[model samples]
Target chain A: MKTLIIIRERDYVWLRTVFPDIHPLLFPICNKPFIEFLIDFSILSGSEAVRIVSDGSLIDVEEYCDNGSLWGTAISYSSIMSMDDQRAVIEKNRRFCSEEKILIISGLVFIQYDKLHDYKSLFASQPNGDLLVCNGGSLSLTGNPPKLQKNSAPLSLSLIALDSLDGYYRLCMEILGFASSPYVLPGYNNEAYCHIGRNVVISKSAEIRKPVMIGNNVQILEDSIIGPGSVIGSNVIIDRKSTVTESIVLANTYIGEQLEVQNKIAAGNMLIEPEGGICITMDDPHLLTGIKKSGSVRSLLRFLVHSFAALLLITLQLIPFLILSPILTIQGKWKKSKNIYYTGTAGETLTLTTTTIERRGFISSLAAALSLDRFTLLFSVLRGRLAVIGSSLELASDSNTTLHEVESWYHAGVFSYAEAEEWPVSGGDKAIVERYFSVHGNPFLDITMTIKAFFNRIHETNTP
Target chain B: MIFHVDGSTGKKLGIAALNGRLDAKNSSELLTSFERWQQQTNLIILDCSKLDLIDSSGLGAVVSCLRKAIEKNGDLKLANLSPKVAMVFELTKAKKLFSIFTDTGSALQSF
Candidate 1:
């Protein structure tokens, strides 16, 4: 049977106020996006194809679910008018709903179903009409109903309207309190009620009381207490001495040291008292802030180390640069151009004279191998303007130049870590390699990377 | 910040109504005015019903006012803390230090 899941904008408008960044359908319930539960139910009920119809933007959901190949089902997306009713949606998707029993699940509602039960046969046997519904939404059958044997027992089905924060919180708590066997919850559940995800670093001094679900890349710091009833999302850090009980700490949130978070929903810097729906965006970074990599001290140290390295390199390469640069220029092997390039800071540009060396003859190849082409840019390091080894030089006028996720930590340099690692010096993955070293590489490591990059540049046969 | 002496409960109480934001920009002003208000009466109630926002500096200034009041053997209480301001107090664990009330009348009567 085919399924059409219609989610109206008004049904999930409240979620926008709480989670501004997340789409309503992508809102996590028990560390799982709400739409995934619906998809799971459709798959269990023997849906060969599923189409998610929404009046709201389905970009995130589409990106996440894709063609539903992950779930072993064909999934499609369609747009609908805000005023579109059930019949209107069915009529719009007439081609998809043709020649089959279509299961219509509408609105922002939770379906309570167990995977152990054979819902496929039960749903196929049930008569077409409204099967189960709640205040917020309904589960109905449209098109044709399949004929079945008379011995089929009534399928246990129920719906809960997730229209308010209180209801949403209560539903999550209920699902969490119960063993997560009913729904497919993300994370590894080695023990009952304790589900953990990848790269979870729980400190030796920290306490983990059961009935908790933690997501990927979570750090429960020293003396931190997690659980009794807690759902921590991905990339969350519970700082030292912080106690999280009966709380849902969303992804990318940093719980401050010594803070007691009880019966709250923390999403980044905003903390919400779910029962009262009271929310407060914290202004202080120390208390309940977003977990972001801000390496000011490391950046300063890198600047000092790079400057010292640049000063040393300049001294050693001075005579070779002075002799080879003029000779290369006179030989028409060195091509120079003054252009603007993008700096680390947004909207900031740097004017630098870039030289391209044509490695045609012995003198030019010697100059290229000696890295005299990047000789003048060494001053930028001494001036504290660039790193010795960082991201690839991005041109300011290049409209196609977009920053990758890792490139946000990018510090443009004369030499890149990608060049040091012998990875592709330009492209998407190059930014990732550079960013990895930028975050992990210290001043000493940077010096080593710079040396490696310098030697690696000796073997370069391609034009810059 | 508007300060007035209230003796409705037959005891001298300084009621300071804080309006708008109490951040780094005007936190020192509150601290300076708090010293002058403390001279009139030590038992003070900070009415924060109109307080929309408060940063760390503002919280520090309020704590300092409480410290000065305690040095004079008096108490500084908070009243009608908005949810936003209360969240700051809770996050910083400053709520434990002050006796918070829902209204100014109750804060005054408690003294």
Candidate 2:
């Protein structure tokens, strides 16, 4: 048997809105990406090959699953259009679906099946048709069964569409609530209702109330309570005195000290009450923030390199700044404004004396070209308030938007990586560029990018 | 934020209706408004039906208002909290501090 998993974008549009960064197939359910479950089920059904078709960009999914060697299943990915019907999808991949009996799992639906059960025989015995149908999608079989068993017990399986946040939350809780989960969950499980993954540091004073699934590199701090029912994803920190009961904390999220996080889904700095469908992007880092992996050794080196680079830039531009500043101020060409900007740390803000030069002449242009406008900000680098090259900083203003939303990779930088990459300064484009640098950055690479940014500013076309 | 005194309960009870959001921007405004409402009636019930969202600062402001009401030898209660706003209260453990009711009518009677 072969499997064809058709995941239309329209089926999981809500997931894109809620988790824009995550691929629909890679959306984590109980700390394991959603795609893994489909692969497992496809393998369980005695499938020799699996082809996943999606309308959206499958680059992330392809990159993650990568030939399906991890699961030892021969998995292939294909693209389909929104208008494409089930027949069209099958026709498009007819070569792959030609020989074998095809098991078609369409839409974003969860298959409730016990791993302990034998599905191969049941699938072989069943007639070629849809096994079950749900509101979101269906599980149908194509091609004739080689030899049907005379009398086969009914397929004890159910399908549920993960359409809404409430449905998704309920599904996770339902799985956890099970005395023995039908689906295979990640992490190490020795006891019932408890799964702890690698490098989990649970403090002596911390309390574990059971029915908890903790992922890799978690730190349950002193006096913290984890789970009565909870899922803590990889690289999570439950700070001292914080209680996470009936909640889902996604990977790389920091739950700040003395906070009570009950009945919610925390992804990085954003908190969502799934039952109510209320999502809150927290501005205060002291409450909740994203934890980027920067070792103390790496951070110290970065700080030193940034400080040194800042000093070099200041020394090089000091003469030009002094020569042009007085003339610009006299000509009323230099405009200074005090704006509050978020610092490198989450929730911390710093006031910068920002200067904008009205470039009508050589002196002003020279000042701008030498990047004199950023001179005041250079001092902040030495003080460890800003990055040498990081995310583009936005003003923390009291605007109409309650979404004081900053991405997890956000860091106020002396020079934005977007400028260095010569990328457009729009929010979406800037985020993509900055996110790349945030992950791929090293102390040495930062200095090179800083130089590129400085040169890039010289070519910056002034409106005046 | 709008404050109203419910006289139907045969006691002095203030009902404050919070609007759209009570975040960092307008949290202090809620605190200031709550102070004035306290002078009229120490028994207060925050009607949060229309309050769609709140942040840490806003949660702090509400907690502070409850503290002030207690210091004045009276009590503050919560009523008609929307599910979204209620999640914040539950997450922060602030629900434990206040006597919550289904509606302002019930909250006023409780006072």
Residue A71 in model 1: shift from native, Å?
1.5
State the lDDT of candidate 1 residue by residue for A68-148, as single tens digits.
Answer: 999999999999999988989988998999999899999999999998888888877788888888889999987775676
In candidate 2 the C-alpha lDDT for residue A334 amounts to 91
Which pairs clash inside model 2? Answer: none
lDDT at residue B12 of model 2 (Cα atoms): 78
Off by over 4 Å in 1: A149-152, A292-464
Q: Model 1 over residues B1-111: C-alpha lDDT tens digits?
A: 889998889999999999999988999999999999988999999999999999888989999999999999999999999987887788677899999999987888899
> How well does model 1 score by local distance difference test?
0.87
- Who wins the DockQ comparison? 1
Lowest-sum lDDT 10-residue window in model 1 chain A: A399-408
Candidate 2, which segments miss by more than 4 Å at Cα? A143-153, A179-181, A292-464, B1-6, B17-39, B49-52
Q: Per-residue lDDT tens digits of candidate 2, residues A42-91?
A: 88898988899988778678778888899988889999999999999999
- Scoring the B chain of model 1 against the true B chain gives a TM-score of 0.98
Leading candidate by TM-score:
2
